[model samples]
Target: MEWLLTPGPVQLHPKALEALSRPQLHHRTEPARALFLEARSLLKRAFGTEGEVLVLTGSGTLAMEALAQNLFAPGERVLVPVYGKFSERFYEIALAAGLRAERLDLPYGRVPRPEDVAQRGFQGLLLVHSETSTGALVDLPALARAFKEANPEGLVGADMVTSLLVREVALEAYGVDAAVSGSQKGLMCPPGLGFVALSPRALERLKPRGYYLDLARELKAQREGESAWTPAINLVGAVKAVLEAVMPHLEAHLALKAWQNALLYQVGEALGLRPVPEVKSPAVAAFYLPEGVPYGAVKEAFARRNAVIAGGQGPLKGRIFRLSLMGAYDRYEALGVAALFREALADILPAS
Candidate 1:
């Protein structure tokens, strides 16, 4: 009955878990190839794109690195809209790639506006669709359109690690040249599978810097029912199960998220806690701590109950806490989390 309601590496679906425990299948086998390709098609639907989807053996960050390596040419200038920890990672990634990366640092929980970088003459725009640290979901379509309008020659890239399946987004419609996601989040599978869906334009032309993450090579291999290297067969199996058994119910899943979001907000308000002031996320809810409450103490309290939620990160640390209702979670699990959170809050911030 213990719940793990943190953002990434969420609770796995029963079927995915069961599938993960099965014996490995050779990566190049027909059955394995079919599973991998099937997962890709499911992922295309998840991303709402007819574009090419490539899966790699790494975390979501790996896909981000792949995008930076492949897309950012040396001496290129890129715009990153920063609001939380993950967004900061993109800025850092661009800098590490030796690109002239500039960012519009906005307040936490605030979505970046289209006008924020209207005149920025950058060659690319990097964005995180959901700021997990602050539990904020940005207007990705608007930002993508804005970037496209401002710099038609430039490309739009998105990190959908937290939003891929749990949140609604159409990569093609949003003009996202590349979008990255991980199995640990919305896909409700084991960690290690990183996915990137690329528009045809991006696929036709990208100078990948890294040998391991060459989308050209990976895509070719995948198309031929192969891998560039030994694949993570177990994790791929888990993802295949997720794609087969879970993703088909996307509408119901989204409805469940909406319901959970409203219920959590109602529960938090009843306990005198409030979400960060902005357009909150349906996947993760970041709540401002009550006055006189100690963050570490409350986190430890949850741990003592054999459950683990997340404390905020970076600038929001110790002030806001996050709860993720991703993966195979439902109202029954929500009720458990709510009860534990209530008890912990009462213990930490008793009537005053």
Candidate 2:
């Protein structure tokens, strides 16, 4: 059995794998449309939104591009809160799409305060609900209130790629205008399928259809119970199966995550390992290496024992290591991984 601890492309449930192996269906066929509609309905329930859900055959980045390309006109200004690698990408995509983008940079492992964004005037606001790279969780409700108060015209958007099914986002209740996620993260399916939900007010900001990334066309096709282009039949089928299986047990899934994180923290404390922050994510836990111990040595030592742990991204590389507790992980698995990590660290850096 391969143990995966990385963020995206997380460990898949056996049922989801079985769903992917089912007989292929044509995208234009009646069965395909029914499946598409079923998936869309389930997605709404998953996102806890009454707004429209758009299914795309690309990654989560495609959903982001679609929103940027269709929602705003040229020269529109957007404010992106940059805390990790994925959050920073939102700014890059908006700029590349020809929109005026400004960034509010926050150090990794710390959430941005609402007052910080309230000072900046912008038409659109972007957030990464869970920054997997840094294991930082933003306060969605506070951020939404601050953005709306800062600029009434601002449409709030979030990248829920890492937090979706694992945590409670409640986009409608939280005042989020638009949000996006991929199938692989919390949805417990494979990559290649992107999910997007937009508020009616946010949808009203769209310009005329100019490209395939147009949300208008996607929405129109979705209204007819289909996708604009041929859909990813296998992946959509997997998503439908996964959602059906997990919907009733979502709370249990999140509880398992909590249990795993707590177990990891217990083991880390016993082993004298330092957590990166006082507030840790239930989705993932990032730890700082003991002083005088290099991250590379610890990573290789873990790899030798057939366990995979993630290293930090961008500037934090070589300074920290991340272990994902999302998906179907259990307390035993968490304990095993924690033992392996502690053993690895002990081998690399002895007590002094």
Candidate 3:
């Protein structure tokens, strides 16, 4: 009866849950291989990529680490644009991996202009397609084109963690060298498995890959319908179910998101609550709280209503809150949550 509106570890479909309930199979057995192949094929279809989709047994951060380890050598310069919490995580990963990293820091919700990044001499660029923390979306095509034109040899990696299956991003057409996403967001599954898709340019640049975080090795194994390490069998099975359910309803999904976004605007206007960027995410919508209302109180109030919403991350912790519109929920459920949120605000904020 709990409604999840958080970005990651989103609401799972009943069918996906049922898929996970299936009895476990040997990871090396034929049944497991068949499941793996089915999940991999569905992933490629979801991403619209002919390139290999490597499934990692960890969260999306694992894929980010794989990208850093596989694509660049130590001391190679990488440009990362910091617009939100997740984007900053990419920078942290790059630095920890010992890669020389340059950051283009934009205030949360503001997109860094392409010209701002062109001056940096970087061998790779890390971008977050949608900044879930502040609900800001970067111009994916413009960012990709900017890096490609600046350094054709450079790899363009993206954290499509929040926007992958929910929104349409033409990875091949946009020239994105590599991208990563978790199973939870848009995939309608639980968070355990991660997906990474690499372009030809990225594949060509891969060097001696580390054992666990090696994209090339994973891709090689995945192409042969295997995994380099023990795969998440249950999560993979759940992903297959989620993909099967979503494939038929892709159009309905988009339409629902469109409707939800409009309703969010309407509700926010009624409550005098302003969106952080004045822009919305088809995946998640973040709003600024009215003065004198505590974010924690509002969250608790929503919990009482049997709904959960996410609060802002990092510097925006108290001032902003986020509502995820992605995953299995429909407009009716979201509107119910929105109604509770409006009521919570009314209880806390003074009348105009």
Candidate 4:
């Protein structure tokens, strides 16, 4: 079987795939409303919050832009901690939204300390819980607490696109004002649905931004089990299936993390590859290629073996490679990936 090891748009879970192929339902019907509402509840559990979770018909970036639009007015100063590509995207989005985005730039592999962020006197904070590009996981709870302590009246928004179902996040406990995520990464669904989970405080702070992304209007419509516009009906069904059929297995989550750590250490050591991040992520792993090993050759070799891997992006181009463990891979499938990875590597390395 072919392996999809890229960071996003992961191989869909079987249940989600099946659900996606099911007959579509009209968005205004009672059955459709129930499905949407149930999915929203499951999303709340996934985010570990009691607040409202609004579903939108776009990718994760849509939710990011929506947060920037609704949470802060134009010219409001917002602190963005940029460590990798995805975090930097938030910084750009803030600037594009007309916010005075102040970036606390750090190296690719290192994250900003919570104590350090508290000193940045911005009216709002934008966070990336897991940087998929560098495979670095941030201490989100600590950062959220620090931000709240420093700016009691300020808002804290998180882009949890890669971390939502892959890692544990307590939005309310950590005082995160809002968190945005997508269906493709941790949720093991297609790329159509974007979710925003907001605290009561954040909900109260929401205002009209634009027609499609206005969170206030979306919130009101979603509360009554409806959408303000036509929704991604099939994708919503797929998400509902994933949340109901796949998400309740707590043991599977624990097992996946343990498996991922073991696999990364074992495979990385065997290949003489060093991890790129100071704090690695369970969802994505980035490693520096061994000396003289061409990134293109290695990636092409994997592709020839029907194993899809990803190269670095932006400034990281050709410097590192990333492997993702975002889908619902069982023990045998995980072992298959490890074996295929070794075989693919052997195809490129010099003969012993």
TM-score of each: 0.96, 0.94, 0.95, 0.96
Ten-residue stretch with the least lDDT total in model 2: 203-212
Candidate of highest TM-score: 4
- Residue 284, candidate 1: C-alpha displacement in angstroms: 0.7
lDDT of each: 0.83, 0.81, 0.81, 0.86
Ten-residue stretch with the least lDDT total in model 1: 258-267
List the candidate numbers ranked by lDDT, top first: 4, 1, 3, 2
In the range 1-352, model 4's lDDT, one tens digit per residue, is 6788888988888988898777878999999999999999899888888889999999999999998998899999999988999889999999999999999889887888988779556889999988989988888889988987888888999999998878777788877989999999988998998998998888888856888999889988999889888999788888888889756785578568557746965786688778888887787878888678879988988898888899988778888998887876777787788887788878877666
Comparing 1 and 2 on lDDT, the stronger one: 1
Model 1 per-residue lDDT tens digits across residues 105-213:
9997788888886755888999999888888888888888888788988888999998887768787788888899998998888789898888877886687766888
Check candidate 2 and list the clashing pairs. Answer: none
Better of 1 and 4 by lDDT: 4
- Give the alpha carbon lDDT tens digit for every residue of 1-352 in model 3: 8878787778888878999888887888888888889888888777766676789999999988888878889999999989889889999999988899998888887776777667547899999888888888788778778777888778888888888777776567777878899988888888898888876666777864688887767877887678999888888989988888887777777778767766776787678888886345677878887777789987887788787888989989999888886868877887886787678677677767
**What is the overall TM-score of model 3 with all chains considered together?**
0.95
Ordered list by TM-score, greatest first: 4, 1, 3, 2
